[model samples]
Target: MADTITLEVARYRPDRETEPTVEAFEVPLRRDWAVLDGLNHVKDNLDGSLSYRWSCRMGICGSCGMTVNGEPRLTCATFLVDYAPGPVRVEPLANFPVIRDLVVDIGDFMRKLPEVSPWIVRGEGTSVEEGEYLQTPEQLADYSQFSMCINCMLCYSACPVYGLDPEFVGPAAIALAQRYNLDSRDEGADVRMDLLIHPEGIWGCTFVGECTRACPKGVDPAGAIQRYKLTAALQSLKSFVLPRGPR
Candidate 1:
């Protein structure tokens, strides 16, 4: 590998223009450097004007998600060696309003999160002091995969449905809602049903499956949404038959 490389980063100054532009920075990159490290090099040594969001250098924080060479990925886990020979393009996650260089506004995702009501709801004695709610391993497995979302919004960046309808409750948020719904300890499944059946809810997803593919943490948003769809369909059918059934 070369001693250094030129990383082409996409820059968008929302205050200045409606469109995004590209800027390049020559960094002293080693083969072992992660993309976030290269970004820091650009910010610290090469160009102070270059901007991006990052937190924990490890992949857990999920704060440094971006598009590397047109693929949405967590920068902390993506390495420079993967894209050798210089001149790798780095950009903010796509399909969202840009706040500034390499930082897309996450308001849409936040809105969807609220729409899903992502929280555990129980009966009147909701306090933990009441008792420990228990579940079998089989119950945990039902929604275990969906609970791994880090809210990085990379799935939104990969989803075409969000690009088409900004009002749609996105994949990550919906998947999270399903997580709680399937949890044996939580009893708030009926409360979040409206979100699942809304026109701009699960119906918005086109099964593109890009959201799941782009997630670095193996959070399967596509699978979660599909499972929620089936559950909602069965619930709707049951509602027609049982008068006091889950609404």
Candidate 2:
């Protein structure tokens, strides 16, 4: 293995540069060092002006997500050894506005996350005195896989639908909505139906399946979307067969 590896990091300073540029830096290619570590080395030793967002190197925070070799990945978990003996391209995630250098604006996702109401919503409140809403093992299994989302936004970065239409709610948000909708304790499935059933919501997804492939947490957002689509179809059919209010 080479002692050092080259990292071509994308840089964009709106105040200084009109276009984004790539700068190369060499760092020790240790087996233990990840792409984030290399970026830290550059910031610490090479360039102090480099800007990016990262927190909790343990991969729990999910803030270190970036495009490495044209794929969305968590830089904290992606090691340099995997792409050794050459330059690795580290760019800001796709389908988002660049805030500075390696940082991209996630405001779009932030706004859409709440639209689906990815929480257990009930009209009647159960007070603490009423006791916690408990779930059996079978009930917990309903949405456990979808519950693994760390909000990495890699799924968004890889989604072509979102790349084309900015209004698309993307994958993680929809999957999370499904999570709550599947929960036996939640009564707000109807509340989330409108937004998710809209053209730019779950319907926007073409099921390219890249979102699922890009998911590091193994959450099948694509499958979740398909399931939700089927669910919507069934509900629509049932409503048509059995009209509401009075016959």
Candidate 3:
């Protein structure tokens, strides 16, 4: 086995350059090491100036997301052997402003998450008691899948819509909205729908599905977004048949 691995990493020094560029590093590595571990090795031994973000290397924290060889993935979950035989390319996630090497500004992504109001909205007294709000197994199953999102923002990085126009709500936020909409207790879906399924909402998704592919948690954000669209369309059609408001 080779004693060292050569990595072609994208480097950006905001104070020094207007654009990012590629630089190579040769460092010793083990076959059992994850990419995140290798990055630590680079930062520790080969270059102290390398920049990246990471936490909870076990993959639950949703940090350490970056584009490895042009594919967005959690560095904590990606292994070096997966791209063996020599040099690997590491870069920051796409579609966001690069703050530095392997680090992108995610403020817009976070703001979008808040725009969807990603939470349950029950009355104050509902959960004030010690017992939990009643939920059946089926009800839990309905939204439980979508609620697993770790907020890695890899989906946004993989989305072409966001790359083309950052105004688009992107995938994760819409999926989170649907997660609450599917909830048996939440009443905030309507309040959030106008922000979703609008021109800049789910419709903006060309369905390239790269966002779904990039998700590390199997959240299936594309499917969730599509479900939101269908539900919104059906509700719009039903409004015609419903009785008029109380006179």
RMSD, every candidate, angstroms? 1.7, 1.5, 2.0
Give the poorly placed runs of model 3, Cα more than 4 Å off.
240-247
TM-score of each: 0.93, 0.97, 0.94
* lDDT minimum window of 10 residues, candidate 2: 238-247
Estimate, for each residue in 1-247, the C-alpha lDDT of model 3 and write its tens digit: 7877888899999899899999988766787788898899889988899999998999899879999999998999998887876688999999999999988899998888989989886655454557877899999999998999999999998999899999999999998998898999898877888788589998888788988989988899999988888888887667656746321
Q: Write the per-residue lDDT of candidate 2 for residues 60-84, one digit (tens) a residue.
A: 8989999999999999999999998
lDDT of 1 by residue, 73-192 (tens): 999999987887768999888898878899888876776686677887777655678667777999989878888888998999999988888888888988899889988878778778
Ranking by lDDT: 2, 3, 1
| Candidate 1 whole-model C-alpha lDDT, 0 to 1 | 0.85
lDDT of each: 0.85, 0.94, 0.88
Index of the highest-lDDT prediction: 2
